[model samples]
Target: MKEGRRVYGAEDDDPPGPQPGHEYVELVGGALDGQLLDVTSWAGEDREGGAMLITENGLHGPGGRADYEPRPGTPDKWDWQGDYP
Candidate 1:
């Protein structure tokens, strides 16, 4: 999926991704009561930012053992949050 480039505050030409002064929230996928996640990235960052909703969970993707399941109990372990700005 593609999202429109957004700029917050003084950054009128900021690129897509997480920005220090900017904040973004996206609903990944989950049931009404199930866990929901949001992925975000700053304007000057290559890595994406993520957070868990409904539950204090974590984000995981790629780089894992032979078996990998995108679930709460079977997370792959990733550090989406970073210091930028």
Candidate 2:
């Protein structure tokens, strides 16, 4: 039998893996519910503002991006704002 294709963010552009001082942040909702985000470069308000990460729409190609913002009172995690073109 043949293996099936991944129709998710499994092959998306992830952070440079885990590193010192660069802890991982949880990604809630959307296509990246259990994904982690690296906001090491985001400083102060920038971290609070949010981000629009590019994600090749799995199987669809040029699939747009995955929006995420820091959860209220939860700085260690980001909530998915939704996907966009």
The top-ranked prediction according to TM-score is: 2
Displacement of residue 59 (Cα, Å) in model 1 is 15
lDDT of each: 0.29, 0.65
TM-score of each: 0.18, 0.67
Best by lDDT: 2
Residues 1-85 of candidate 2: C-alpha lDDT, one tens digit per residue? 0123222333456433354575457777876666666566667888888777777652224757888888999877789887887
Residue runs of model 1 more than 4 Å from their true location after superposition: 1-21, 31-46, 49-85
What tens digits encode model 1's per-residue C-alpha lDDT throughout 4-83?
Answer: 53322224555554444433433323221221222333332322323322222222222211111233443323322212
Residue 53, candidate 1: alpha-carbon lDDT? 23
Candidate 1 lowest-lDDT run of ten: 60-69
Give the range of the ten consecutive residues with the poorest summed lDDT in model 2.
1-10
Clashes of 2: 1
